[model samples]
Target: MTSAPKPISAIDLFCGAGGLSLGLKQAGIEVAAGFDFDESCRFPYEANIGARFVHADIAEVTAEHLEEIWDGAETRLLAGCAPCQPFSSHRRGADTSEESNWSLLEHFGRLVNETKPEFVTMENVVRLMRMPVFEQFVQGLEELGYTVDYRTVNGPLFGLAQTRRRLILVASRQGEINVPKGLGNGPATTVRDIISGLPVLENGQSDPTDPLHRARSLSPLNLKRMRASKPGGTWRDWPEALLAACHRKPSGQSFQSFYSRMEWDRPAPTITTQAYNFGTGRFGHPDQDRSLTLREAAMLQGFPVDYQFVPTGSKPTLSKVGKLIGNAVPPAFGRAVGQTFIRALAQSIEQGEPT
Candidate 1:
């Protein structure tokens, strides 16, 4: 009888709260370790995922360190989704010339070359395609003899409730590889699809049973504004008296997404670090007079309902927890990518080739 295929192992760099690790584990890949510079991530990442969490910057990580983490696995995989703020659409007109995170992609490329892993993957904002650093990273991979393929993907198409667009790249030393087309399952996930069943709370009220379900208290005037707002409607629909001075200006007239309530039937706008604040983006809840709670934001990001964001006795601050949720790769999308990696590896094994 033929032997079963050996399991592939991976190490995630810039792993925040272990979202990718969770999804990859669900897809049958063994995540050996996760490394990130954020110290706040240690509690949640270690609590929920099986991988060991290393609190160190990626630039300081060496191939020897990674090989030590990999232990003895022959099918080594290195995955990194470096911070993409420098290449995000939000920085379009701003001075991003000195952004500290700009060189992280280059650092990622260096590790890939040094480690010489058989399989590699990277996820970043779609705007990354426009940057010169992105070109250099791809060229570096090619020079290392990797066949790379990448494309922009919509999160909702792959079962995430948030409307996030990201660039996904896959590389293989064994042969050419491609990102799998999204499964495009049944109906698109909606805001209500994930958050409808959570316990209801008044504006600024938190469910005592779940600390992460706490919503920030809105100011009286903002409460009134939220009451007047309708699902999928913008601040433009509000009365003249409640409008901000900036909104009255021509420049602000185009910022329609601010102070807007999410429609129940459609996927939510991308969840950002400020998603818990009503004034940031279209974060207000439909029919509720407050923005999305931390738990709700995590749900929209495809994190499991029971996923731990902070340890016991540690206060669950919105800023700290929101960053973890907002920056995570949707677990569903990660699962799809993990499955694709497995297929590529299996194909190589069948042909008696190394991957």
Candidate 2:
């Protein structure tokens, strides 16, 4: 009889919609539990990922709680992608005095230091490197005797169709660490490459059989607004009468680019939580008459066609599903990081480092 493969186990922190957990599972690791404060995530995280979802604030989770959950597992992997909203490039020129996201990484460090997992991995926006907190985070890992490797990587280089970039950091208690090479940027994946084959829907239409494919309802004024919009066109193309009052001024002309349509032959713009706002970003479909639906947005995020993040009976609203998709680390990127973490650990084990 053939022997079974060795089990790889992990615990995911700040697990939003279980994207990283799902990717790790794809690589043969079993996620024991996911910790997050979003109660809205509980249904999707549990239903789709099949991992125990703890809806507690991370600042309140104790080391004892983690130890009890590990249950003497030989090799424990701790993974997290801290909230990056406060440290994003968009927030650079603004005052973020009220943002609490910066401190979460420190909390992550505290938990890892106390629990002493054999391996660790983290992902975030590239702009985070500019923060003094990030520097201290790297120094803290070295103090704990971890061999760390951190770098920013583009998602499309790893076979993801989107042009999203993220900072990935992997550290091992055992030995040296390095990120894996990119699979190479061969072809630029276009919007058609991802969602082209899916069933087509008109504005405010829904696939009766697939709730997840439903498009958000449009207001009558907005319906008339989009009809005047063209793929790759801006509000400049709209009739003068339909333009927003502010957009009618010279100062507002600069912001006209915000409400634009996506080009058909090019890669879609970065999908954000408010991507359904046709005027908020390059969210309008290339050749279609509607903004990118929740299903299309999820697909562009590298989720498999049949991947289930929302429940069957749940209404797939733009705001709700957008938060779920937007907050998720693209599974393709997650898998790349997971493989690198595993390799770094294996190298450390062979060379006999700290763990």
Candidate 3:
């Protein structure tokens, strides 16, 4: 009889909605715990991930906590993707202010230094490279004797239908860890592929039954504005009477994607926290009257069709659910990173090298 392979374990920090943990579980890794500061996230993280959620600041997490959870595991991984809004290009690099929110990455480094986990991984917007702090992070890992590899990746090329690009980093004390290779030149998945079959609704409609599948309310003026907008159509296509005051302004003239409809054949625009508003971004459905639904946004973020996010009585507003989906790392993207780590671990075991 053959023996089973050794088990792998990981602890996830900033584990919003448990996207990364779900992916790690898909890759056969046991999640030790999910750590986050948001008490609101605790129920969802624990319910979906089947792991403990530590609803405290990461700064309060001690080495003993990590050791206690990782006990009896052959390999330990410390994984996190610090909040990326501070480094996002959409915000035009204004996230450089020394605000408390900007220090999550530094906190991640502290956790690594204190616990000395065998493996470390992180994912964020590619714009993070523009900051000097990223270099400091790399140097800190190197100082701790870790072989680190990182690169920018396009999510659509790796099974996600959204045009999401991210910076992923993996480091190991056992040997070198490389970024997942892109599956070159395949056809991009489109909006229709992700949400073609769901029941349709109007601009301000809900399923009446499936509360989680509801759309945000639209104002009377906005409803007329959306009706005039067709798939892939811009504000230029809207009737003059329905145009918003900003649309007529010289400063707002350049923003074309607003109040625009999505193309059925094209990958979706980046899902944002306000994706249900036709005027917010390119969130309108290709052939439908309304903006993208909450379920559609979740699907584009690579959540499974049945993945439960919100609970009973709590209405799934576009802004709230969009924030959850937009903030999450796609599970497929995490699986790709996990596979890379698996290969690196195997190589280290074979060659007697440090990971």
Candidate 4:
């Protein structure tokens, strides 16, 4: 009699609040364990993902440890979305290659070379594509006899309610695999589609039932600015006096997306770590005179409405939560990733066999 195939499992590196883990679970993949340096992620990852979460710096993680955590799953996946600040477009023109923290990508590459998991995946800011490190990672995988492919995908194309563009890479030692291209279907998801139903809140008001729905307080001057700000409109729409000194300068003209409002019919702008701050990007509400609520930011990032990022009663600090949400890979995109891997695995002739 033929033996049953061993189930596929994944070890998530830099798994923030378990977004990728949750999506993998949603796609029927077993998330064996998650690793990150943040202790705050333990509860949410374990609670929601029902998987083991190890709070440790990726720099300290070893391939042996990751394999041990794999627990003998015949088909294993190693996935990571290393912190991207060093490679972010915002820091362009300044060389960040020598920073010790940027070595996190090197660590990820080392683990892949050592562990040689059946599947490997990575996600990061699109700007990473231009970096030599990205070329090294892709070439290293190919040298290991793995078929590798990568692409830049827009969030809305993959069911996200925002327009985040990211670079996604997938490698398989078993067989040829491809990245999932979001089909340009009918209408893309929009802000109203995601957050229109939440209970309304004024600036500085919190929902009694769900504190995550609270909006950040806006100053009087900014409040008037928001009121005058049209959805998808720029800061130039404001009265000349309301414009910041920077806005008066020609250099600031290109920064029009800041302090604007999201259109109800379109996907939200990329959710940044400061998404709750009105002055950052087009985070203001479509009709309300305030910036996005915490929950709204999560929704735009493709997290569920009730997704838990903190302990039941522990306070959810806005900046921390924003960072967590902003740094997360959208669950919708994660689901697509999980689905694509599963599809490729099914056709993989290796089938966890000794090659």
Point out where model 2 deviates above 4 Å.
1-5, 85-100, 349-355
User: lDDT for model 1, on a 0 to 1 scale?
Assistant: 0.86
lDDT of 4: 0.85
By summed lDDT, the worst window of 10 consecutive residues in model 2 runs over 85-94
Model 2, span 1-355: residue lDDT tens: 2223245568899898888888888766778899887787888789878989998777778899888878888778889888875332233354555344577788888998898887888988888888878898889888899888889887778777777888988888767777655787588777888989888888888888777776666677777777888877788898888888878788888875566777766777777887777768878877667777777888888787777767777776678778889888888777877776666556655556443
Q: Model 3 RMSD to the real structure?
A: 4.0
- lDDT score for residue 25 of model 1: 83
For 255-304, candidate 1 gives per-residue lDDT tens digits of 89898899999999999988999898999998778889999999999987
Q: How close is candidate 1 to the true structure, as a TM-score?
A: 0.94
Best-fitting candidate, measured by lDDT?
Answer: 1
> Of 1 and 2, which scores higher on TM-score?
1
Considering TM-score, which of the candidate structures 3 and 4 is the better prediction for this target?
4
Best by TM-score: 1
Worst 10 residues of 4 by lDDT: 85-94
- Extract clashing residue pairs from model 1: none
Per-residue lDDT of model 4, residues 78-122, tens digit only: 988988744322343555453433567878899999999999999
What shift in Å separates residue 206 of candidate 1 from its native position after superposition? 0.9
lDDT of 3 by residue, 28-108 (tens): 778989987766667678878999998767666778888888886788899988886433223424445634344778778
Q: Candidate 4 versus the native: TM-score?
A: 0.93
Model 1 is weakest, by summed lDDT over 10 consecutive residues, at 85-94
lDDT of 2 at 231: 76
Any runs in candidate 4 off by more than 4 Å, and if so which?
1-5, 86-101, 349-355
